[model samples]
Target: MSDLREVAITSDSSGQLWNACVWDPFVGTTLMTYKGGVSNSHCLSFIGRDFLISGDAVKPLLHVWALNRQEQIQVRMVCPGKVGALAISPDGSYCVCGIEEKLHVWQVATGRLMAVIPRHFQRVTCIRFTDDTTHFASASEDGSVIIWPLCKVVSMTQDIFRSISDSAEPRYTFSDHSLAVTNIFIGKGGMRARLVTASLDGTSKIYDLASGIMLLSVVFDVGLTCVTMTIAESRVFLGTIEGKIHPLCLHTPPRSLDYHLTETEKQNVFSEHTKSITCLSVSVDSSMLLSGSLDEQVIIWDVPSMQCLRKLQHKGSITNAFFAIVPMNVFSNNLKPSLVLSSFKRRSDTENEESYCINVLNSERILCDKKSENKESLKYLAGQVLQLKSQVKSLVGANLELYRGLIADVWDGHDDDEPDPSFESTQEVGVHKKRKIKHKKKRNLET
Candidate 1:
C-alpha cells in the first residue's frame, strides 16, 4: 500500500485558466486542474477523498467533479441561495452549507435535503465539522458560534423543504464575539477538542466543546480574517486584515489577572502578503505553514524557521488554500474511482428516493473505454472499489447511535445513566460509559 504524498490545493476568485489546482509545494509543480467550479472564500472543499465540491462564486450553482476528472459531471444540484461556506463529513455521508442566514443539511449519497435550520439572525460566515464528524460548528455575522450535533440535525425531517422546529435548538449557542465571526477551526479528538473562533471584534475565543465552557480568550489589536493551529496545537496563528500573521503561545498566559494577547505579547508576526489574509492552513506534519491572501499570493513557510519558502502566484485574489493528500491512483486510467451511488439531486420530491436516483458511472461503460488494461487489473480494481464502499458505509453508521445517545443525555433529562459532561481524561470517560451500560442492564432486569 502506497502512502500518498500531501499537496497544496488552491483557488482564485478571478481564475481564467483554472478554478482549482493541485500543486506540489516542494518542487512548485502544478499536478492537476479542475475547471467550472468557480467559488469564493471557504467555498471549495472535498466531499470525502473521491469527489470535489465547490459553490459558484457569483451564482447559486454547485459544481462537483471526481478525483481524476477536470470538468464537473452531468448531475446538477442547485441551492436556493448563494453559498457562503460549505463542509462535508469525512465519511461523505452528509454535507452542510451556510446559505445566507440558513444552514442547509443534505444526505450526500442520496442527494436528499434533510433540514433547513434557521438559527442565526444574520448571514453565516463560516462552517466547520469536528474531526470525528459527529458535530459541526457554524459562525455567523450575528456574532454567534453554535455547535450542533450532526445526527439530530438530520433527524429533524425526512421530507423535502422542511423547517427545523423551535424545539430543535443547537447543542451550544456561544455569543462571545462582539462582531461578525470570520473563521472557525476545530481541533482533533472529537468533542474533547478545543474550538478556536476569530471575529471582527479583534479577538479569538477558545471554548471546550464537550463542556461548552470558555477556556481562554486572546484579544488582538486588528480584526482577524483567518485562523489555524498546528498538529499538536501548542500554538495558534491568527491572520489579520492588516496582512500580518500573528502567533501566540498557549502556555504563556500572563502572570497578571487578565489573560490577554497584546502587541508586546506577540513575539513574532509574519508580514509577507500586502493585502488581507483569506485562508490559513498548517501542514499535517506541522513543519510548514500555508497562507492565502487577497494580494494574489499563496506563500508557504517553514514553521521552524518562520521564513517564507516559496510563493504560488495567481492572477486574482486567492480564495481557498489548504493541504490535501493526493492519492497514488489519481492519474491511473485503469484504477479510476467510480461514483455511481451518488445522485446529487436538487431536491427530494418523491417518497421513494431510489426511484429517481441517477447513476453517474457505469461499470460496462468503463470496461468498454479501457480496453488495454488486462482482466487481472480490472478484477483487482473492482474488488478494491467494493471494499472501499463497504468501509465508507460502515464508518458512517459506526458510533452514530453512541454519539446520538450521548447528545440526548446532554439536552434531555437523563432517563438513562450517562457520562459526565466535563470529562477530563480518557480513562474517566471509559469508566463512566461502562457504568452507564451496567445501570441500563440493571433497569432492564428489574422491568
Candidate 2:
C-alpha cells in the first residue's frame, strides 16, 4: 500500500460561486474540478464521496452539491444572524450551522430542521464532529467550548430552548480560554479520546473526552487560528495568527520551568506566509502538513524534517486547504501524492471575475520516507530483549533450586552434636586461632 496521499480543496472568493478541485502533488497535475456550487462565504464541507455542503455568508441558505450528478440543492433555514461556521456529521445524517450565538441542526436527507441550541454568548467560531459521530462540539467567541450529544440534540424539538439554569446542560463545557475559541479538533478513537481546543488567548488545551479533565495546556505567543493532530495524537500542529506553524509534543513537558514560556525549544516555526494562518490539515499517516494563510499561499510541509516541500501560490487569500486522500481510480495509471488548495480573491469595482479557484498540484518530489519498517524493527528488538530476560530468569531459578537442594541434603545428613564442618572450617580460618590450635597440639604431643 502507498503511504502517500492526495488533497482536495474547496474555496470561494467572489462570494457567489465556489470551486472544488483535486490535486496530485507528486505529478503537479489537476486531476479533477467541480465548480458548480454557489457559496458567498468561507463555509465549505465535504459531505461524502459524492456530495458537498456550502453556506452563503450573506444569506440564510445552504447549498448542497452532488459531485457525481453535477446538481445542486438548496436548504433554507431560519437564523438569527449570518452563519459563521458549519459542520456535517460523519454519517451524513445531520448538518450543524453556527449562526451568531445559536446553533441550528438540520437533517441532511430530509432537509428538515432538527433543533436549535442557543448556548454561546458570542459568535460561534468552529464546530467539529467526533470520529464516531456519537457527539459533536462547538467553539465560540465567548471563550467556551461545549460538547453535545448527537442523539440528544437530534431528538430535541425546534421549540425547545435550553435555559441558563437548565439542569440538562451540555456533556462538557470548557472555559479555560480567556479569548475567543478558534478551533476544536477531536482525536481518533482509543481508550482515552482527546479533544484539542485552540483559542485567540494564545493557548491550546488538550482534554480527555471521558473525564473532561485537561491533560496538557500549551501556550504560544500569538493567537492560534486552527489546529490538527496526527493520527497517533502524539503531536499537535497549530496555526497561529502570525502566519507561523507550531508543532507541540504532547508526551513530555518542556524543559523550561518558566510559566510564561515564549516559544517551544527546537520547534520549527514555519514562517513562509506574511499574513495570519487561517487553516491547517495533516495527512492520515501524519507525514505531511498543509497550511493555508491569508497571504494567498498554501504550503506543503514535510512533517518529520519541518521543511517546506512545495509552495503553491494563489491569486486570492486562501480560505481553506485540506490533505485528503484521492482514490486510486481517480487518476490514470500513475499514482502519485497530491495537494489541494482553495483560494478566493474578492474583485474590486473594475474587475468582474469569479473569486474562487481550487488548485491541485502533484508533488514533484517525495515528501517523507515511510517509517513503518523502522517501527517494526524496533518492536522486534524489544521482543527479543524480553525473551532473553525470561530465559535468564528461568536459568537463575533452576540454579537456585539446585543449590538449595544441596544445602538441604547436607543438613539432613549432619548431626547436631558434631557441628557443621563448613561452619568449623570457617571459624578456624583466622591466623591467631590456627596458631593457637597448632601450639595446643604440640603441648599435647610433648606430654
Candidate 3:
C-alpha cells in the first residue's frame, strides 16, 4: 500500500539471521529492512517510535536499534537469563522482560535494575502491558496468570529488606487455566479494564480487572494459542493449535461460568492457517486482521469478508507481525534518534565501561560519515535541523525569563534594604507615626 500513515512490520524470525522488515502489503513489496537479532512471539517492542528492540532467542541479550539507523545499537542489554517474552511500558520509561520463569524490570534510560520477580513456576510465554501502562500481565507455562501493578513492583527496591519478600508478590494471581496460558490481552480503562487470556486447555477466559474475578469463559474443542478482540469489542478471535481461527460473538453478557463457541462452516472464513498461530493483531480501525503462524506465513485478512487479502511467506517461522500507524517520515534517512541508552548495561559492572565508551565513539564516527543521498534526504535533514533550532530557541527564551525574574528579585531586595543606615522609611519614625495617625483619622471619620 502507498499509505504512509500505516506500515506493516514483520521480522524474519530465524533467530540467527533475523531482520526486521517493513512492507507495502497491498503491493507485496519490501520497503525497508532492519538488520539485527531476531525475536519470538511477544518479544518485539517499539519504544516510543524512536527505537526498536527484540530479545535474541539464543542469547541473554536484547538487540536494540534507532528507527533512523539500519544496524542494531552498539550496546545490547544483557538480562539475567535468555529473554523469552518482553514488554516495554507504553511510556517507554521502563521495560519488563520474562527471562525463563523469572521477570526482570529495568529502567530503560539508566539501565538500572528495578526488580526481580519469580512468581511463575514455568517458563513465561507472554508478557503484556496494560493500555495505561499502570499494570502488566505475565502468562506462563505453569497455567498461571499474574497481574502486577507497575508502581508496586518498583516500590520494593526502595527498601532493602522489603524488596526481598515483596518483589515476587503480584497484585492479582489467577490459576484458572488447567494448561499453560499462551497469551493475554488487556483492553482500555486502566484498573477497570477487561483481561482476555488464551490457554492450551481449550478455553479462553475473560476477567474483570476491577474485581479480580472471572467474567466469562469460552471453551472449544481445540487448544488455543493466541487470542484478540475486534476494535469495537464486538467479537473475540481465538487462534487454535489445530490451525483454525474461531470467531466468538460477545453479544451475550457473562452470566454463566462457561459457554461453548459456535459458528457454522459457512461463516468460518478465517480457517486458512494450516499450523499453530503464534500471534495475532488487528488494525487500528479493526478493518483487517493480521496473524502469523509457525508454518512460516503471515496472513492479512479483511475482517468484513474474513478472506485472506495477502500472504507474506517468510524464510523462517513468522514469530511477530503487527500494523503500526506512524508519521509519514518515520523511515526517512538522516533523521537523528532522540533515544539515549548508552548506559544500558551488560551486567551492571564497571569493567565493561571502557567497552561501552568505545562502542559509543564508534557509532558517533559512523554517524558523522553519513552523506545525504538525494534532495529528499537533504530536505528531511534540513527540516530536522530547523526543528532542533526552534527547540533551542524556546529553551533559551525560557532561561532568559528565569534569569530576568531572579535579577528583578535581587534588585528589588537591594532597593528595599537600608541605604547606608540613612533610608527615609527606616529612619523616619515620625513619618511612620503621621501615616498611622492618618489611618486612625480615616477610621474615626468612617465611625
Candidate 4:
C-alpha cells in the first residue's frame, strides 16, 4: 500500500479549523492541503492532466494549481461573488466556474475569460458537461436543471432575454424538482444519455436529455448529498445523508418506462460509514468506486461485486475526493489510479475529539489535520446551486419548442396520413425493434 502516494488540501475560515485537506490515503501521506480561507473549498476539477481547479467561498476567484509543480498555476478571478463550483470540459479547453449568482467560462491553458454567463435569480450549485462537448448542464438552488449550448453561450448572451418576452413560451426549462438541486450528473452509456440530479428534498430525478422530460424519480428518507455516474456502464449512484446508497440501472428503448429496481439491488445500503456520504468518485473505466463521508472515512468498493475492499479513515469529516489514473505501461493492464482524499475538522472542538483534523488514508494509515470553514460560505453555495438550477431550467424551457421539435421528428412523422396499424405500436420504433424481434422469436419457438 505504501506504493500509493498522497496529497492534502485545506481551506480557510474564521475558526482556523474545519478546513479540508486532500492527500494520499496510504501511510498518511500528504499531497495538497488548502487551509485558512474565508470559505471552504466545495468544488474541484482536474484540468489538463496535472492542473487542478477549485472553487471556494469568499474568494471570487477559482484556484488553479499545477499538481506536478505543486504550485498555484493561476488564481482565476472572474466572478463577482464567491466561486461556489468548478467544472472542466472534457477537452480541457473550457472550465465553468459557478459563482454565487453567475457563471463564468474560462480557458484553462491561457487563463483567458471566454464568457460570463449570468446565473439565475437563485444561486448555482453544480455545473457539468454532457458526454458530447456540444452542451453542458447546471443545477441551481431553485430546483431546476438548465441545459445550455456550449457553442452558443457567447452568442446567446447578446440577446439574453429574448426568450423571456413571452411568458407562455414553450422553452427548454426542466423544473420538476420541488426543492433545491444539490447535485447534477450526466450519464452516458450505449446510445442513451441521462441527466441525474439529487436535491435537498430527498429525491433523485433522472431526465431524458433528448426529450427533456423527467423519466424516473426516486425518493429517499434522507436528503441526497451527492450523485455520480460512471462511463463504462449505465449505473447511476446516489449517496444520501440517511446512510444509504441507491444504484439504478439506466434503461433504453421499449422498456424506458420500466424504472423499477431488481429486488437484490433496492436500497443497497452500506452501513460502515457512521454518517452521511458527501462525495463520490468512480474509476475512469468504472471498475471501482470511492466515497467520502462525514464519518471521517473513505470507502473503496468493487463495483461489480459491490464489496468494500478498503476502509480509509480520516482524522475528521471528509470533504471531497478524486481519482488520478496513471496511463498503462508495457507490463501492467494499467496503474491503479491513486485516490486523492480530502477531509476537514473543526478547530475548536475539544482536543480529545477527532473533529479538529483532516486525514488521508489509503490501504494503510491515515494522515490528520485540523482546519474548518466559515459556515456562511457553505450555506451560500448550497443555496446558490438551487437558484441556478431554476434559471437554467427556465432557459431550457425557453427552448422547449426546440426539444419538442426533436421528439416530434422522432415520434410524429411529417406525413399527414396516420401510420398503418401494424407499424403504430411502439415495437415498430427503431429503438424497440430489437426487443420486438426477440419477442417474435420466442413466440414462434413456443408454437
Number of the predicted model whose lDDT against the real structure is largest: 1
The model with the greater lDDT, 2 or 3, is 3
lDDT of each: 0.83, 0.69, 0.78, 0.61
lDDT of 4 by residue, 327-383 (tens): 222113332324322211111122233322222225632333233244656778989
lDDT of 2 by residue, 26-62 (tens): 4545656555534433367766444566666566655
Worst 10 residues of 2 by lDDT: 341-350
Off by over 4 Å in 4: 1-42, 74-78, 109-112, 156-171, 189-192, 251-267, 327-447
Ranked by lDDT from best down, the candidates are 1, 3, 2, 4
CA error at residue 21 for candidate 2, angstroms: 2.6
Worst 10 residues of 4 by lDDT: 340-349
Q: Is candidate 1 or candidate 2 better by TM-score?
A: 1
lDDT comparing candidate 3 with the true structure:
0.78
TM-score of model 2 vs. true structure: 0.66
Total backbone clashes of candidate 1, pairs 3 or more residues apart or in separate chains = 0
Across residues 37-86, which tens digit of lDDT does each residue of candidate 1 receive? 57777888887667788888888888887767887778777888889989
Q: What range of 10 consecutive residues in model 3 has the weakest lDDT sum?
A: 353-362
TM-score of each: 0.75, 0.66, 0.73, 0.59
Q: Return the TM-score for candidate 4, rounded to 2 decimals.
A: 0.59
